[model samples]
Target: MYHIRASILFCGITFVFNFVRADYLTIKEERSYADPPTGDWVTNGVITPLDQEMRNFYIRNADGVIEVLLNEDVQIGLQTRVQRGGFEERKVEFTIGGKRFSYDLPKNLYVKRMFKDAEAVRKWEERGRRPIMDGKLYLKPIADHLPTPEQPWISGKFIRENGRFIDVQIGREIFQIGTQGHDGQHRFMGLLGQKDIKPFIQQAFVHGKLRGDVFHASELCLRMLEDSKAQDDPKLGRYLFIGDSISGNYDKALRTALKGKLNIYHPPTNCGPVRKGVENIAVVRRMTNRGLVGM
Candidate 1:
């Protein structure tokens, strides 16, 4: 049996990873949390819903460095396993996804550090493999040349640090940042006057072109609709989404707003109107009955 055992030692942490014998691609991710009891760790990914309720994965590596996986591919991008050990000590038994990643180690350095190096990650992925190193920030650089002059764009980081909004510019654009608390408007609206009623337009004017990040939600929604429509009809191309809005709940309100704009953005002259709703799939049935079928 060929095995590679690596250990990383850090302040208040010690981690060990072992490649055990297995047929399936076995990748294990283990970490210790930073609470009083000290070594609370959890493993989660897209392949399986997290056994725990927390959305953010914050666990310390055996070497004490914070392990962070920013994208979805880390989970469903590759399937892995989890093995829990003693407090502050865990074992990950797995193999690289595709090719065998063998590197001559630099003497006297931590084995975990060598294995977790970015270069190693690049090499491993080059062969269509997945490495099981989690808990480190992954920042892909912005290209020196951006979109053409015709396509004016802006991008920045919206960080809410220490009760203050900080907009870190990314090359040319500045973004707005803010946070909201739970205590706000709530009422029965039971015994209200007739004048209090206004037609809910569900209007949302999303300025997606302002900066690259601003229009992501709108862009994604449109993309999904287009993909679905294209699947339904191959010859006809992509599409757009119209919505209606309620100022109360952003989630449901956005859908309502999108519903209203369907005819405007995707006029009869172009692609027909498409409404993708979350509340239920029945909305599409209603639209079809109204004679607004996809062209």
Candidate 2:
């Protein structure tokens, strides 16, 4: 029943800043329901260029633009990989400029796809639409070093177990999951915790590497369970809109634009106008009635 989660991150606002430059640093705060009416996360973002390097970037908040810098390494192209999936490709690919780039090391990559193109997705639709993940998902890390992806399969929540605050029976254990392929530098960043991890004893995952009789936990994924919805927090809101071909034409773009924050659902067939709506709406209504989706 444990679902995977993600590490802390946030949304961005666009603007050009003359002073201070870096790649990314944005903070967003939500209603901390755990802390109730008065509980709100106050945030300020700061990014330092590590030993690896630095880049010119702009930061922002509700008021205006903010940028912080640390190191002297602006990648000639882009540091993060831009993965692309399409009809022609059998697997999703990172937009590695040319075949030659520095720091090209092996990475853990996991993706639930048979291929990258529309045809592959269409073929999948013919089936049950279940997840079509690659076989070697999170088996182990290629590099046996500290801060490896697979080593930190850890998370937990505290409950009164026997007599102590042992989270033997806790919520989702699937935080910070990832995968890697042997052939390429492609890595898959699966799930991450919503917040920065705390100490191992309290709100973090209380597990570790199997060495002798001791457990060694280098990093931990932190989580706060919701009362009504168990440990899972549905971050995005799903909305259904019925319309003609116009809506259908822009459907993909709309979804792409609002990728992570919200999801927009539509019927299989376009509902068209009022008279058309009457017929198609019934199908949609049946779908909704059966707990498929809602308005």
Candidate 3:
């Protein structure tokens, strides 16, 4: 196991990454809360329904549209009250997939329940991915330089510190920063709002240049183990790859590249999505000796 300490400047912010080697490190998806409504007239909520009350509904965001299965009929529970000037304020509360969410409908907004397609629902559930925003934030990676095992990849981390926003792109994936609600927490939505991506790029990029720090996965694992000063163990330096089918391919490639170099671990079953990652984080943390790193 080895350690590499590196620093870089991004968006006028300095970020330091500590890399270490271990038998295993966890790689999971990134998850964040949907952005809050921008005005008083708009509100947000989660949908969670009872097990027996299954239904299908469509959710549209700027990036794309997806149909979600609601465990209950949501329209039947819609509540409306008269506002000033003969306007109506509509609201609904429902549960889906064990999570409760709610949304306030605009005066003229229309929502329809789609006919259930078991196969479609199954496939959607299988994807295990969710939209990062209620509307479009236009967050897309530049295709100029593709990430590879040789060069690896780096992503920007938007952090809120002392009531100010500091944006920095580190070599490691965004998920390595840890979960939300911790000190030095990082979020993509907190720094940029929905709708336009132009302004975000303009502010985050200095003179249209993006700076990134680089570290090979093996080197990172060594650094992590060394930093923890974990005692030598045959099973100590392993890397666990967990994600959906897309991520599965990545795992295979990584395993091939790192063959005979490090111990790579992955489950027979591919992990579903960010939600699944959130659910199984504790188990992954427990399995890894030095701790998990997100991708």
Q: Write down the lDDT of every candidate, Cα atoms only.
A: 0.22, 0.26, 0.26
Local accuracy of candidate 3 as per-residue lDDT tens digits, 153-243: 2233322111222222234422121212222221222112211211101111100011121101100000000111122235545454444
Candidate 1 displacement at residue 277 in angstroms? 14
Worst 10 residues of 1 by lDDT: 215-224
Please report how far candidate 2 places residue 110 from its true position, in Å. Answer: 42
Off by over 4 Å in 3: 1-236, 281-295
* Model 1 vs truth, CA RMSD: 27.6
Ranking by lDDT: 2, 3, 1
Best by lDDT: 2
- TM-score of every model? 0.15, 0.19, 0.18
- How many steric overlaps are in each model, in order? 21, 22, 34
In candidate 2, which residue ranges exceed 4 Å CA deviation? 1-233, 244-248, 282-291
By summed lDDT, the worst window of 10 consecutive residues in model 3 runs over 215-224
Across 256-278, the per-residue lDDT of candidate 2 in tens digits comes to 78666654444333444433542
Q: Write one digit per residue (lDDT tens) for candidate 1, span 109-174.
A: 110111223444455446653222211111222232222233222223322222222233335653
RMSD of each: 27.6, 22.6, 24.7
